[model samples]
Target: MVVGDASLEIDTVVIGAGPGGYVAAIRAAQLGQSVLIVDKSEWGGVCLNRGCIPSKALISAAHQYETVQNASSMGITMENVKVDYSKVQEFKRGVVSKLTGGVAGLLKGNKVQMFKGEAMFINETEVRVFNDQEAPRYKFKNCIIATGSRPIELKPFPYGGRILSSTEALELPEIPKSLIVIGGGYIGAELSQMFAKFGTKVTIIEGADMVLPGFDKDLTQLVSKNMKKHGFEIFTKAQAQSATQTDKDVTVKFTVDGKEQEVTGDYLLVTVGRRPNTDGELGLDMIGVKMTDRGLIEVDHQGRTSIPHIYAIGDIVPGLALAHKASYEAKVAAEAIAGLPSVVDYKCIPAVCFTDPECSSVGYSEAEAKEKGYNVKVGKFAYVGNGRALSLNAPEGFVKIVADAETGLVLGGQIVGIEASNLISEVALAIENALTLEDIALTIHAHPTLGELVMEAAEVALGHPIHAIVR
Candidate 1:
């Protein structure tokens, strides 16, 4: 094998075929630019193959299992209900395979060149992708880095068969009779609830006082209460010191408010957080890419890196580590590469937690609005007051609206109830469009639907809620 001066000419090259990378490639190709996408792993990257799809598939199955277990209370009697762990894994694998295949097909359809290899920045305008058992030199023009991120493993308890990260949690060989989750963030809360619903005695340990630290306290309190109602033991302000794994059980040693405690379980899941995947033989420093203290790539509004021609997006950059956020940023980067003006508006990005009784927020929280020095008026509508929620037998949460008291403009909205994820989009649209609270209240929402909760909340903000008795 010898090196040749064979130059591969391309208008744009994207590194790491995650949601962000593959999307940038397709958009660049659609905009009439020759594009090449390089990925060290599979085509769909972590999100499709490991993170989002796989996790959600397990959550869905767990939800179904819980629903069936509670069916008798809904006037539907059943007996001998059971969950086949292997079957669940099979279904998850099938889901991932279909999605990964879809992504591959899409890249092919767009005529985007795909390379299965690790990519390293050789220079400012070039990247070298190395395939297995091959020399490390494949050239490219204009590269976009979307290498994504990986779960943050705690120092005390490393990942093993009995100790897991979110990735391993999604691939559980068997349901543990008792599971202890470290961290009370969205990942921990969501997975803990899912396992609890599957009859696992679940305990969540968080060094913080609440499950979701950055979320509005009241909203997070509701989530915490719901988790408790589902038989989850939450140990707030608890820190894990170490973990000991044995053949049949694992023991977690921790402290809460200076008091020592221990929790034993069949497995331990560490979901503290995720770190950016910015390391490895990427030659990033050689190319002069600016990075943050946490090893995340620094990028501008248009996804341009320190080196003007190079770009970065997704978890590698600061902001929410969301797949949709990465996809949106990828579009902006691709448009910029095509010599089109593009900028990302972070105001309307929605964040949702897919736990039992989903929690979602967009624009701002009431606390965030106040912190920003805005005179805010808060409105609330409980699911207990909604006819649809009553019929569905999930009348446990509420929808809250925060508006500018002076202008009656919708500042932000948060919903904690069933199907809240879908309902939050209306709030996002309102905030993005700068619509007034009156605008949402005036819109005709269909009867016998959960979305009326949104209308009711808006009306509450206007002091004229129709569904609930006005305070």
Candidate 2:
């Protein structure tokens, strides 16, 4: 529609108004750049609308349900316990709406231009935004791609009513009487536990030898034990061949440890992994953008793609496919585009699994430290030894600290217990600051708090723990 060359000029253009795109746009605007953001779908993207926020709402509801069921032990008795799935869906929708609205307001408040359409590249310097009625084109000095990823669908089991992806699992009409989850990663483990707590007979089948593969084996063992304790079945070294759906049920066929087995359930969740959403008219190939074997765009530390002015961040790029990581990378890319030096420190990113008793880790694991040729010393303090944990009736897990023996520096930290997700932030901060084990041990932690477990673990590393008997 615009014939004049002056109409297309923009200082910075961002595609896909998810967490990364919106944040980048806002930061660029704040830095006094004329910014424009374009998105094909909702502004908040998958994480705000479907992935992180919605899933956490479901998990929170499930936890409350479990709490009600156990109220008798807390000197409280209830006549009956029940869950209204529709109300849960309403609550999740309300949350997504509020956050998405806030994002829109934020963009407007920052004076960033917003476009609602799919963006495709016409050339290295030009991008075309296609809307239903008309196609508008804009040329920018710099562009950032924040197109996120989608749930990976297994070839053996296509997504349907019986065979569901994580998205569909978040919107269950009713909790299935029995559920089978394929994939032993964090997604599978967390969702399986949530459903089990909601009274669904849950089972997990993983091709790997353990659930939460790539995690510290000890932590994985604790997760497995907790699942078993909650009456969930877990099968490792198992590969699902196919799933057959019928009117009454769905039967999953898999081989476990060279033994053929079949499990039937009301639903099957496919959470093997997620793939980048890089296709759909983006014109990436025309711009000479290099992509990995998995179709993820290759970007530098500052999020610049092969094309000098074009950058990519979030799930469209690499590293951990988490929302917060995306946001951090967006800032770096924005700052770099504004002719400022910005670098993303990948080592400080934290990963958390929101199971009943959460699991979280940051930086190097003990095995990773050893593989890197470091003389690692580990210290572990169980929740059973923590007064707060015992009072809360969730003393099943422990915190493990891995540090350099020579320098007493904290290399990594892992925790598997209640509120472990929030607890891992301190470890991340310590790792980012290069804090030593001795430093953490010397710091005084408040009494009757779960956080004291971190200090206790550091004390154990120093061979002098107060709460538990030192061996």
Which sections of candidate 1 miss by over 4 Å? Answer: 1-5, 133-139
Model 2 per-residue lDDT tens digits across residues 408-438 = 9898999999999999998898998999998
lDDT (Cα) of model 2: 0.89
**Per-residue lDDT of model 1, residues 1-471, tens digit only:** 325645566788899899999999999999998888988899989999988888888889988898788788789999999898999999999999999999999999999988888887777776677786653454555778999999998778899868999988888788889999999888988888888888899899998888988777767877888788878888988889999989888999999989999989999999988998898898898878999999988899999999888999999999999999999999999999889999988998999988777889998899889999999988899999989898888988899999999998888989988898899999999998999998998899999899999999999888887777774
- Model 2: number of backbone collisions: 0
Worst lDDT window (10 residues) for model 1?
Answer: 132-141
TM-score, per-candidate, Cα-based: 0.97, 0.96
How much is the lDDT of residue 440 in candidate 1? Answer: 91
* Whole-structure CA lDDT of model 1: 0.88
CA lDDT, candidate 1, residue 137:
52
